[model samples]
Target: MERWLGLARSLVIYHNPATVRAWRRFYGQILRPGDLVIDVGAHVGTRTRAMRRAGARVVALEPQALFARYLRLTLPRDIVLIEAAAGGAETVARMAVSSRHPTVSSLQAAFVDAAPAAPGFGHVRWDRTEEVRMVTLDGLIARHGVPAYVKIDVEGFEIEVLSGLSRPVPMLSVEYLPGFASLTTRVIARLEELGPYRFNPVVGERSGFLWPDWRDGAAAREWLAGLPADAASGDLFARLP
Candidate 1:
C-alpha cells in the first residue's frame, strides 16, 4: 500500500523536500550518524531517505498499508519501515484516501480541517477509504529502539499524535497550523510538556533562515504566537530540556 500511494502522491509537497531546504538546514544539528529517527508520518519515505543519507538509523512509521509497501522498496534494507500510525496504542482507525494527492491523505479529520486554501486541497481525491493500525513512540522504541530524533507532520491531529508519545525524544519536529493558532498553542504546550522548545521558521523554500533573538522559550513562543496565519507553512523544531 505504501508503494502504490507513494507513486500516486509523489507530486504532493509533503513528500517533496525541495520546498523545505531551509528546514533541513535548521535541523542540521539533530541529524547525525547512528542516531535513531522515528519518522511518524513516513509517507513514501522521502524524509526517511533524507535522514538515512544524513546518517541516521530511520524507523519510518506509516499507517497506510500502501505507503508502507513503498517504504520497503524505496528505503534501504536496514531501515525498519513499520506499517502503522503513531498515536498512543496499537489500534485501527479509518483513513481518508486521496484520489488527487494520496500523500496528503490522512485518517485524522483535524489534518484535513487544517488544509491550506491552496492548489493541493482537492489533490487527494478521497477515492478510497480503509482502516490502518496505530501505535505509539514508546511502543516503537520498545520494538525497535528509542530514537534520538522524532519528526511528526500529522496535519491538524498533531496534538493527538504528540499526546500519544510516552518517551522523551531529545530532538523533535512537528507541523503547525498557522491558520489555527489554537492548534499551534497546543503543539507548543505539548513540546513544553516534553521539555524546553524554541521556534524557528524557514520562509520561501530556501530564501533564508528566520531565528529571532529571543531571550528564552517564553519569548520564542510569544513571537510565534504573533506570526500571521499565512506567515509560514513549516514545522516547529524543538529539543528536550
Candidate 2:
C-alpha cells in the first residue's frame, strides 16, 4: 500500500503544468520531423509524450522495473519503450532510488553523499535498491535506428550512457549534477570531444541561466573539471561535429 502511495506521489510531482510547458517548448523547438529520440531514464514517459507530440520516434529506456512498467502504460502506442538502462556495456546494474523522494534516484552513491549538504536534501529518503537490465547505446541504435536527439537524465549514470554511443547523434541533452559531474569528468571531456557543447539550466524550472562555453573542446573539458562542489541541475546540449 505504501508503495502505491509513493508511486502516486511521483506521478503528481512530475505532472506539473509548468514542467509540461517547459518540455513542450524544448521538444517543439529542438526536435525535428521524423527524428528518432532516445530517452534515457524516461521515468514515467513525460518527455516521451512531449517528444511524440513534436513528431519524433522515441525509444524510452528505463532501468527501474516498476517505472518502466508505468512508462509503458502512459506513453503513446507508437513509442517503443525499452525495459533497460543505457549504460556501459554491462547487461545489469544496481540502481538506488530514494524512498521519501524517489525523484532524486541515482546510479552513483556520490549523489547521496553530496545531497546531505544541499538544499532540500533533508526530506529525501533513499530506501530502495533494484538491479535492472542494461543496454548500450550502440545496441539500441542498431536495434531501432539512429537517434538524432537523445535526452539523458540518468542521475549519475549519464556519463556511462554517453560512452556507449559509438556514433554521435546530432543533438544530445543530458542532465548534469555538479556534484556528480566532477566524478564523471570523462563525460565532460568526451562531450567536448564531440565539439562545442553548450549548457543551460532547464528553462522555467528555475530562472534559467545560460553558462559560459569553451573556445574549443579542450577548454570546455578543463572548465568542467574545475567545477565547484555545489550540486545543481543543468542540461547540456552538444551539436555533434
Candidate 3:
C-alpha cells in the first residue's frame, strides 16, 4: 500500500505532460537519432521515456522491484530495461527502501544516515531493505556499447557509479544535493580523472542549463560550494568539450 502511494506520488510529480515535454526538449538538444543512452536509477521511467521520444535508444536500470515492474508495463519495447543497480562492482547490495518516498531510497548507508538532517528530507524515511543485484558501467558498456549520454540519479551513490566506468562517455549527469555539496565535488574530481569535462547545473526539473557557458570542474565546485544548504536539488551535467 505504501509503495503504491509512493509510485502514485512520483507519477503525479514526474509524468505530467509539461515535465515530460521539458525533458524531451532537453534530450532532443543533446542526442541525435539512434544515439545510445543509459539511464541509471530510472525510477518511474519518466526521463527514459523522454529520451526515447528524443530519438535515442535507451537502456534503463531500476533497482526497486515495484518501480521496475511499473517500468516494464509502461516503457516502450524498444528501450532495454535492466532490473538492477549500477555500482562499483557486480555484486549484491542491500538497498535502504523508503516505502512512502522511494525516490530517496538508496544503497549508500552514509547518505541514508545524513540525509535526515538535510533540508527537505526530514520527513523521508527508509524503513525497509532489499538486496539488489549490482552491475558496473563497464559491464553495461560491454553489452550495450558506449552511450552518447548517461543519466544517473542514485541518491548519493554517484561516486560509486562513476567508479565502475573505466572510460568516459561523451556526456553524463548526476544528481546533486546542496547539503551534500562535498559529494558532488568528489564526483567532479572523478569525472576529471576520466576525461576533460565541462559542467553545468540544472536546478530541480528545469530543462535548461544554469550557466551561460559550460564551466571547468573548479568553477563548478566553486558554484556548488557557494550554494546555500537549503538550495534546490538538481543534476550536474558533465560533457567532453
Candidate 4:
C-alpha cells in the first residue's frame, strides 16, 4: 500500500502538465528529429515520454520492479524499454529500495548510508534490498549505437555509471544533490577525463539552464561549492564543445 502510494506521489508530481511541458521544451531545444537518446533511471517514464515528444528515439532503463512493470505497460511501442540498471560493469548489484519514496532508491550503499542525514532526505527510508541486473554504458553503446544524449539519474551512482563508458557521448546529464556535492565533483572530473566538456545545471525540475554561459569544470565546481546547503537537487549537464 505504501509502495503504491509512493508511485502515486511520483506520478502526480512528475506527470503534471506543467512538468511535462517543461520537459518537452527542454528536450526539444537539445534534440533533433530522429536523434537517439538514453534515459537511465527512467522511473515513471515522464522524461522518456517528453524526449519522445521531442522527436527523439529513446531507450529507457528502469531497474525497480514496480516502475519497470509500469513503464513496460505505459511507454509507447517505439521507445525501447530495458528492465535493468546501468552501472560500472555488466553484472548484478544490490539496490536499496525506498518503499515510501521510490525516487531515492539507489544502487549505491554509500548513498543509502549518507542520505538519511541529508537535508531533504531525512524522511526517505531504504527499507529493503533487491538484486538487479546491471549493464555498462559501453555495452549499451555497442548494442544501441551512440546516442546523441544520455540522461542518468541513478541517485549517487553516477560515477559508477560513467566508469562504464570508455568514450564520451555528445551530451549527458547526471542528477546532483547539493547535499552530495562531493559525488557530483567526482562525476565532473570523470567527464573531464573522457573529453573536453562544458558544464551547466538545471535546478529542480525547471527546464532552463541556471547559467547563461556553460562553464568549465573548475567553474562548475565553484558553482556547486557556492550553492546553499539546502539547495534543491538538480541535474548537471555536460556537453562536448
User: Best candidate per TM-score, number?
Assistant: 3
Consecutive 10-residue window with the lowest summed lDDT within model 1: 207-216
Off by more than 4 A, model 4: none
- lDDT of each residue in 1-241, candidate 2, tens digit only: 5456667787887766666666767677777878999988887677777788778898888777777778777777899988888887857778777755666777767776677776556677778787888889889888888888888887767778877876767777777656555644566577766555644444224423355431444544565566664645566556654
Using all chains and alpha carbons, the TM-scores for the candidates as numbered come to: 0.81, 0.83, 0.99, 0.98
- Ranking the candidates on TM-score from highest down gives 3, 4, 2, 1
Candidate with the larger lDDT of 3 and 4: 3
Greater TM-score among 2 and 3 belongs to 3
Q: In each prediction, how many residue pairs overlap at the backbone (N, C-alpha, C within less than 3 A)?
A: 19, 1, 0, 0
Scored by lDDT, model 1 comes in at 0.68
> Would you give me the overall lDDT of model 2?
0.71
Residue 228, model 1: lDDT of 79
Predicted structure 3: lDDT: 0.95
| lDDT value, residue 26 of candidate 1 | 39
For model 2, the superposed segments whose C-alpha errors exceed 4 Å read 181-185, 194-232
lDDT agreement with native, every candidate? 0.68, 0.71, 0.95, 0.93
Scanning candidate 4 in windows of ten residues, the lowest lDDT window is 13-22
What does candidate 1's lDDT look like per residue over 1-241, in tens digits?
A: 5545456657375456663353455345556788888888877676677677677887888877666776777678998877888775678888776745665667677666556463345344456777888887777778887788888877566777777785567777776556665776777777777766655544434423457431345755676678776676666666654
Candidate 4 lDDT tens digits, 166-199: 9989999999999899999999999999999999
Name the candidate that leads on lDDT.
Answer: 3
- Give the clashing pairs for model 2: 98-126
